[model samples]
Structure formats: structure tokens, C-alpha cells
Target: MLRTIRRAAFDQARTQLLSPLSLLAALAMPCVFAFVLHSFAPGRTTPDMAVGIAGIGMLNAVIVDLLGAMSKEKVWRTLYPALGSPGGLVPVVLGRLAGIAAQALVSLPGTLLVLVLAWGISPDFDWFRWLAGGLLLAIATTAVVGLLAYFLLRFPSSPGMTNGLTGILIALSALLVPNAALPAVVQPIAWLIPQSHVMAWTRGGDIPQILIALGQVVVFSAVVLASLRRLERIAREQSVPLEY
Candidate 1:
């Protein structure tokens, strides 16, 4: 089962890179936001600015690879038949997730390289302390959000609607802005989204905050998986398919 999923994951990465939508989105959104936000930021370029761009990149990771891919399948009604088969959901989920993982595998190292070569920023990647936590959070964020996008896909029956919802989620994440700047009610709402927390942690902003973020990821993951399980059971009963 794991092997099948891993194989699907491999195919997913190859196909994702070939996707024109994914390639353009992966690069363009981050660069454009990076330039615009950096322009408005008080300093010529602040750490927050860099973090925001990187966060957009991560959100793009979810958008292009997982949410986008899932919607693409369902938009064509390709996913439902696959979901109906045995050993099918495993590969489908893993393959979609594998594509999303490819985004991070591309971005995180790329960000570090750009910082070192182009920006002349230095980070202690080899440090006994930094490597473990950094790698862990990066993986954790990707895994949790990939799963969330899968569940969200279940809610959107059409590709366009699913894609649009993801874009809106990214915007409201508020990694580009501050919580206090938002209306009081919205601040708590923003904090509820993992993208907001993932962006904060990716920028090397706060550990305690990210720990809380990881907690949210774990909680949401459990809920999404459990819900998916229920949906699958309902589908098996052939009882008019409510979760869809």
C-alpha cells in the first residue's frame, strides 16, 4: 500500500511540474507579492516582507499542487470513480500530496539558496538546533495543509469553485498584514487558518507560535481524516452521498 502511494507520489511530482498552471502560479504569485509588499514595507526589504513572499509561495504550494490537482480530477469526474475503487484513495491521496510536497522540496531549498547567493543572508542550517526544528515544521506544515485541501475539495463540487476558495483562503491568511490591523473579529478568524501560522513559522518569526500552529494542524488533521472516513462509509452504503 505504501509502495503504491509512493509510486503515485512520484508520478504526481512529474505531472505537477508539467502543469502550466502550477509552474506559472508557483513563480508568479510569490514574486509579484514579494515586490509589492516589499515596496510598501517601511524598510527597503524587511524580514517580514521576505516571509510574506515565502508564505505566499507555501500557500501557492497548497493551491497549485493539492487543491488544484484534486479539483482538476473531480472537475472531470475522474476522482469519484477512482475513490470508489479499493486501494484507490490511498494512491490518489498520496499522489496529490506528493505533488504538494514537491512544491516545498523545490521552494525551501531554493529560498535558502537565494538568500545565500542573491541576498547575502546567512542562516545556520547545519546547526544542531536549527536543522531538526526547521525540517520538522516544514514537513508538518506541508502534510497537514495537504490533507486540509483534500477535505476542502470534498466541499467544492466544481474545480473553479474549489480553486477560488483556496485563493480566498490564502488572501485572508494575513501573513501579508497584521492581526490587529484587521477588524477585531477577523483577527481570531485569521488565526484559525493554518496558512497564517505556517507563514509566521516559515519566516523564522516565532517558535512558540508555530508550536501552537502545529497543535492546530494536528487537531484539524484528526477532524478531517475522521470526516473523510465517515464520508467513505456513507458512500459505501450508496445512501444518496451526503458528504459530496
Candidate 2:
């Protein structure tokens, strides 16, 4: 299983990270947006936006990679065998995500460097805190990845719908601004988003807040996994063909 996961991860890394254009966009767009926000937003808000944007960019890139990995088997008309293989498809999907996560980690430092050099902003925490913060971000993002994977498996052909939903999640998250600045109705919604906890943590929220984020992540992941199981069952029964 570990070997399968590693191979899947490696394949995912090559397919997504080796694309020069995608890599360029992933590395450049966050810095560009940060520069714009720094120019326009009040000085006090720049750091918050910088962290939010960097986190968003990293998660966004990896989530897209996961989606691609999920779809590739279907694209190649190999979904049936892949899913029917020993230990089922979950491990395979996770293996692919391990690779995607690796790529995201590789790109993150450059993104942070851009934040520091170009936007004049970066997280100012001790090493341990930074590690904890990264864990929180990963937990939150894995929850999201689970949700998005459910969607991808549920509607294998509708990449646009999945992409649109991803956009909506980002909008509801603290990636754009502080949750307090969001409308009252949206604030509750933001709490349910993993990225919201990330924003709060970035701004120095305490351990209790981290607990809440961890809880949300666990709940979201559980729900997503259950849904994926059902989707896999249905797909196997219906024998859904390769979807272009």
C-alpha cells in the first residue's frame, strides 16, 4: 500500500508539477495578487491578506492536482481495474494526493518568499508554531480535498461544476478577508471552512480555535469519505464508462 501510494504520488507530481505553464502560474499569481492587495488595502490588512492568499494558492493548486489524478483513470478507461484492485481505490487516491502534497510543499516556500520579498509580509511565528500552523492548514485542506473528491467522483464528467464549487469555497473562506469583515450570515459559514481556521491561526488565534478547526476537519473528512464510498458502489454497479 505504501509503495502504491508513493508511486501514485510520484505520477501525480510529474503530471501536474512538470507542466511549466501550471508551475509558473501557481508560483506567480499569488505574488501578483498580494502586490495588488498591498497597494490598495490599508497597511494594517496587508499581512492578513498575504497569509490568506498564500494559503489559498497552495491549497488551490494541490486540490486541482487531486482532481486531475481522480479523473485520469477514467480518462484512460482504466477506472474499473484501478478501483477493483486489491485494497480498493481509496489508497490509490490518497497515494496520488501524497504526491500532490509533496508538490505543494515544494512550491510553498517560493510562495512565502514572494510574500516576504515582494509584498513585504510573512508569518512571524516560532518554528514550532509554524509547524503546528502548517498542520492545521493541512487538516483543513484535507477536509476540503475529501469534499471535492466526493464531488469529482459523484459527477465525474462535470469538471466545471467542481471548479465552480472550489471557487465558492474560497469565497466563503477567510482567504479573502477576516471573517469579522464578512456579512453576519456568511460568518457562520466561514467557520465551517478549513481555510477560515487557517486565517485565524495566521492572525495568532489560540489553541481552542485550533481545536475547533481540527474538529471541523475531522467531521468534513468523515462525511466526504462516506459519500465517496457510496459513489464508488454506485459507479461499480452502474459501470460508468470512461468519460472522455
Candidate 3:
């Protein structure tokens, strides 16, 4: 299992890196957003803000790029063999997403560099905290994206749905705004979002909040594994292909 996962991760990372256009866009979008925010909301821009933006960029890679790759695999009929592989598709999916998540880490420094050079913003960046918290957030995001792949890959209109979902998640992520600033009713729903808790931790929240975020990651990971099992079972029993 470990070998399979490692091989898949290597392959996925290589493939993504080789795609220069996609790779450029993935790294550039966060910097663009950071510049725009710094230009307009100068007062709100801080080191924590840069970290939060970077975190959201990592998620954009996981959710958008990962799903886009899955869709391509389905179209090219490349996913069928993985589904039948000895280790099954779960590890392959997780590994590929892990690769993508790791690649997304580049956006961290990319965003910070833009802030420093473009805006003369010298943020007191905490490297240890950002790397550690960003990694945890990426893992949780990978699990959530893997689960989303199960449903989104089956539809013809997945691209539109993917964009819509990404926008919604970002709006509620609380990376740009405080949770307390959100409406009382929406606060509960935002708390349930893994990114919200993870962002809180990244921004120097207390220990309990980080624990809750890690707990959510574990739960989401378990749910993803179980869903993959069900997906495989249904595919075998009903002759249902991964895509419609």
C-alpha cells in the first residue's frame, strides 16, 4: 500500500509539474489575489492574512485541480485500471491528491514574495507555524476533495459545479474575515468547515481549536475511505462506470 501510494504521488506530482501553464496559474492566482487585497484593504493586510490567502490557494489546487484531473482521467479511461488495481483506488486517489497538495505549497512563498516586493509589506512571517498548519490543512482538504470527486466525477456538468462549490467554500472559509464577524446563524455552519478551524489555528488560535480541526480531518478521512469502498462495490455489482 505504501509503495503504491508513493509511486502514485510521484507520478501525479511529476505530471502536474510538467504542465507549465496549469502550474503557473496555480501559483500565480494567490499572488494576484494578495496584490488586489493589499491594494484595496491595506489596513487588513498582515502576515496572518498572507498565510490565510496561501492556505486558500492550496485548497484551490486540491479542489479545482484535483477534480479537473479526475475528470480528465475519466474521459481518457485512465481511471478504470486504477479502480481494478490490487491496492484499490483509495490509495491512488489519496496519493495523487497528496501530491497535488504538496505542489500547492509553493503558493505560500509566492504570495509572501509578492507582498514583500510589490507592496513593500514586510510581514513578520512565521515559517514554522505556516508550514505545519498549512500541511495539516492540505491533508484535510485532500480528504474533502476526494469525497467530492466521488459525486462530481459522475456528472457532465461537473466543471460548473466545481467552480460554484469553490466559490462558496472560499466565501465561508473565514480566512479573510473573523468567525465572530460572520452572522450568528452562519457561524455554526462555518465552524463545521475544516478550513475555518484550520485557518483559525494558522492565525494563532488556542490549542482546542487546532484539536477540533485535526479531529475533523480524521473524520473526513474515514468518511472518504468508506465512500470509496462503497463506490467500488457499486461499480462492480451494478456495472456502473465512474462517469456518466
Candidate 4:
């Protein structure tokens, strides 16, 4: 299982890192957003903004890129072999998503550099808090992306679906704005997003919030694994073509 996962991760990471467009989207776009945001409000760029920008980059990397890859695999009819592998779809998908999640980490330094250079803002960088929160956020986001892939792969004709879902998640992530600033109705929904709690923990170093975020990751991961098993079973039982 570990070998299978490592191979899948390596393959996915190699493919993504080799793509100029993926690099631009995952690394360059965050810096651009940071520059634009700082330009708009000069001195008002907060550490939270840095986190938000990096979070957006991470989301784009994991959600957009992962879904796009899955869609391409579906079109090329290449995922069929992986589905029939001994480890099946869950470990392969999880490992591939892990590779994308790891790639998303580049956004952190990119965002930090832009904040320091463009806005003259030095955030009180807490490595422990950031790493803990980031790890949990990555896990939760990967699970969510995996879940989305299950649906999106079934309907590969909708090319914009990934972007649309990514946009909605970013809005609800509390990365751009404070949770308190969101409307009352939206506030509750924002808390449900893993990034909201992860951001809260990152900014304030709140233990309970991180714990809640961990719990959310656990739940979401379980759902993703279950969904993958069911998807595989359905494909086998109904003779559904996964590469359609």
C-alpha cells in the first residue's frame, strides 16, 4: 500500500511540477493577488491577508489542478488501470491529492515574500502554528477535492465545474474577510469550512479551533474513502465506464 501510494504521489507531483501553467497558477497567481491587494490598500495588508492569499493559492493548486488532472485522465481513458490496481482508487487518489497538497506549500513563501517586499509588512510568522494549521487544512482540502473529483469525473463535460466550486470554497473560507464580517447566515456556513477554523488557529493559535479542524478533517476523509469505495462498487456492478 505504501509503495503504491508513494508511486502515485511521485507520478502526480512530477506531472504537476513539470507543467508551466500549473506552476504559474499555484505560485505566480498568489503573488500577483498579493501585489494587487497591497496596491489597493498600501499599508493595510494584514498577516491574515497573507494567509488568505496563500490559502487561495493552495486551493487553486489542490482543487483546480487535481480536478483538472482527473478530468484529463478520464478523457484519456488512463484512470482505468489505476482503478483496477490492487490498492484500488482510494489510496491512489489520496496519494495523488497529497502530491498536489504538498505542491501548494510553495504559495506560503510566495505570499510571504510579496507581503514583505511589496507592502513592507512583516507578519509575526509562527512556524509551529502555521505548520499545524496548514497540515490540517491540506488534509481537509484534499478530502474535499477528492469528494468533488468523484462527482466531476462522472460528468467530465463540465469544464467549469472545478473553477466554480473553488470560487465558492474560497468565499466561504474566511481567508479574504473575517468570519465576524460575514453576514449572519453566512457566518455559520463559514465555520463549517475547514480553512475557516485553520485560519482562526493560524491567526490566534487557538487549540480548540485546531482540534475542531482536525475533527473535520477526520470526518471529511472518512467520507471521501467511503465515497471512493462506493464509486468503485457502482462502477463494477453497473458496468459504468469511469473513463467516459
Candidate 5:
């Protein structure tokens, strides 16, 4: 399994290396984020800002690297045949992982560099801890985004609508607004989003609290992956020859 995943990763990296749009999309988000966040909303550049920006950076990276490419694959009829190969699901999924990883790698550091050096903010680097927390956050968001990608791939009638809806979800799920400031009606809903906890942790919340949030993100990812299992099976079953 590890060898399969490793090969999938290498293949994906090679594909992305040639994808100019992937690199452009990855570059655009964080640069725009740093400018906008630091310029207009400097007051909001607290720990939460770090986390929120990082979260979006990570997500956008993942989407550009994985979901966006996956859409192209579906459109070009490359995905289903790949899935039909032996030990296929793992490779397909891992290939997605391999492809989009650059997004996370590039976006996170660039955003943080802007935050710490340019913006003069720091949330204690601690590489091991940061990676642990980041891995959890990244994986969780991937699950949600991947499930969304599946549905969109299955039904591309309105890809624009799908992307728009997802963008809206990412904005709200960001939890940028202070918990106290949230409307009473939406408070429960806001609290329920996995990204909410991720936002909290990003803001340099209490260590214990951050761990709890990590726990929630992990649990939520598991829930999302579990929920998608049946859908994946059914989608594959009902799917026909790949679209061109």
C-alpha cells in the first residue's frame, strides 16, 4: 500500500509539474490573502487571522492541486479507467493526495512568512507541533472538499454553481467572527463547523483547547470519509464510460 501510494504520489507530482494553472492558482491565493488581510483588515490579524489565512491557504492549495485537477480528469475521461485498475481506489485517492500537496507546502510557508516578517506576527513555530496540527487540519478539510469534488464530478451540470457554493461554505466555516459576536441563531451552526475549531487553534487559543479542536477536526474528517464511502461505491457503480 505504501509503495502504491508512493508511486501515485510521484505520478501526480509529474503531472502537476507541467500544469501551469496549478502553480498560478497556488500562487494567487496567498499573495492576494496577505495583501488583503494585512492591508484592509490589519486589526483582524490576530492569532485567528493566522489560522484563518493559513486554513484558506491550505484549502485553496488542496483544491487547486487536487480537486481542480480531478475535475479536469473527469472531463477528459482519465479518472474512471484509473479507478478500474487493481488496488485502484487507494491509488486514485493517494494520487489526489500527491497532486495537491504542493498547494499546502507552498501556501502555508508563504502565508506565514508574510504574517511573521512582513506583518510582524508570530504564533510560536515549534515545527513538530505545527506539523501535527497542520496535518490534522489539512486532512480534515481534504475529506470535506474531496466528498464535494466527488458529487461535482458525478454531476457537472453546474460546476460554477458547485464552486460558488463551496466558496461560500469556506467563508462561513472560517469562523473569522468572534464567537461572542456571532448571531444567536447561527452560533450553534458556526460552532458545529470543523473549521471553526481549526480557526480557534490557528488563533493561538489555549493549548488544551487547540487539542480539543484538533480532535474535533479528526473526528469530523472520519465522519466525512465514512459518509462518502457508500456514495463512492454507488457513484462508481452507476457511472458509465468516462466523459470527453
Candidate 6:
């Protein structure tokens, strides 16, 4: 299982990160989005928050890659064969989840570097806080990615359906602006999104809030696993096979 996870992560990095064309396609839009986010922020004191908001765009890029990978598996008729493997589908799906997280982790440094150099944004926190925040962000991103992957895979015909939800999530995250600043109608929705608290932790939120963010990740992960199992059962009942 460990080997599978490693191989999956490696393959994801190679295909998406190492491939010149894929890198260009994947990074282009995110870079543009990041620039726009920086323009909105335009604040020197809260550089960390601004950078975090920009970095969120990169997370979206990773999500798109994972969605594309899943779409290819189904379109190319490889999902069934993958599920039928000796290790079963759980490890494969878990590996994909891990791979997606790993890909995001790997890209974070470069993302930060770009924000620092290009946007002149520097996190005002200490090294220890930065490290802890990075760890939390990775876990948070994994949970969010898993949930979105479940939706995309479950409703393969409407892959773009998750985009609207993701946009709402980003807006509700309060990365670019404080939740208090949000419009009255949207303010309540911000409380429901984990980022309301999660981002706070990275920006010096209390211990309790950080723990809540961690708890959210755990709950989201379990939901993702349960959804995967349900999908597997449906595939079995349908007797889906990879017909070449």
C-alpha cells in the first residue's frame, strides 16, 4: 500500500509537475488568479493572509488535476481494472488522495516563492508558526480535495458542477476579506466553511480553533471514504468493466 501511494504520487508529479506542457497549462491560470487576489489585498501588514488567499488558487489547480485524472480513468475505462486489483480499490483511491495532497504540498513552496518575489508578500509569522500553518493547510487541502473528488467521481457527467461550490467556498473562506466584512446574506455561510476558522489558525488563531479545523479534516476524510465505498458498490452492482 505504501508503495502504491508512492508510485501514485510520483506519477502525478511526473505527469503534471514535470511535464512542460502540463505545467504551463496548470500554472498559467492560477498565476493570473493569484495576481488578481494580490491586487484585491494590497495590504502590507497582512501579507500572510494575502499570500494564503493567493495560494488558495494553487489548491484549486491541484483539485482540477485530480478531477481530470478521475475523468480520464472513467473515460478511458481504467477505473474498473484499477478497482479489481489485488490491493482492492480502497488503497488505490487512498493513494490518489494522498497523491493529490502530496502534489499540493510539493507545489506550495514554489507558490510561496512566487508570492514573495512577484507579489512582495511575506508571512510575518515566525518559522515555527509557518511550519505548523503549512502542515495544517496541507491536511485541510487534502480533506477539501477528497470531498470534491467524491462529488466529481459520483457525478461524472457533470464534472463542472463542483466549480460553483468551490467558488462559494473560496469566497466564504474569508481569505481576501474578513468574515465581518462580508455581506449580511453571505456572512452566515462563511461560518459553515471550515476556512473561517482554519485560516484564522494560520494567521494566529487560538488553539481551540486550530483543533476544530483538524477535527473538520477528520470528519471530511471519513465522509470521503464512505462515499468511495458506496461508489464501489454501485460499480459492482452494475458489473462495470474496463472494456478495451
Which is the leading candidate under lDDT? 4
- CA RMSD, predictions in order: 4.5, 2.9, 2.4, 2.3, 3.8, 3.3
Off by over 4 Å in 1: 42-47, 71-91, 109-159, 163-167, 199-206, 239-244
Report the C-alpha displacement of residue 200, candidate 5, in angstroms. Answer: 1.1
Q: How do the residues 15-115 of candidate 5 rate in per-residue lDDT, one tens digit apiece? A: 77556676555456656666665775664235455555666766766666665665666666766665666654545555566556544655555556667
Question: Number of the top candidate by TM-score?
Answer: 4
* Model 6 stretches with alpha carbons more than 4 Å out: 19-34, 37-47, 119-125, 157-162, 240-244
Whichever of 2 and 3 has more lDDT, that candidate is 3
Q: Between 4 and 6, whose lDDT is larger?
A: 4
| Residue ranges of candidate 5 with Cα displaced over 4 Å | 17-20, 39-47, 122-135, 157-159, 218-220, 223-232, 235-244
lDDT of 5: 0.58
lDDT of 2 by residue, 23-95 (tens): 6545666666666666767343234454566566666666666667778856766556667777566666667
> Model 3 clash pairs?
none
Candidate 1 steric clashes: 0
What's the residue-level lDDT of 192 in candidate 5?
Answer: 64
Ranking by lDDT: 4, 3, 2, 6, 5, 1
Q: Which TM-score value belongs to model 2?
A: 0.83
List per-prediction Cα lDDT, in the order shown. 0.57, 0.65, 0.71, 0.73, 0.58, 0.62
Give the alpha carbon lDDT tens digit for every residue of 128-180 in model 1.
Answer: 22333334434554655655654554564554544565456555666577655
Please give the range of 10 consecutive residues that has the lowest summed lDDT in model 2: 42-51
Clashing pairs in 1: none
Clashing pairs in 6: none
TM-score of 4: 0.89
Clashing pairs in 5: 47-203, 48-203
> Which model, 3 or 4, shows the larger TM-score?
4
- Model 5 TM-score, all chains together: 0.74
Q: lDDT by residue for model 6 over 122-210, one digit each (tens)? A: 44535555556655666676676677666566664563655665466667776656677789999877766566666676566688877
| Count of clashing residue pairs in every prediction | 0, 0, 0, 0, 2, 0
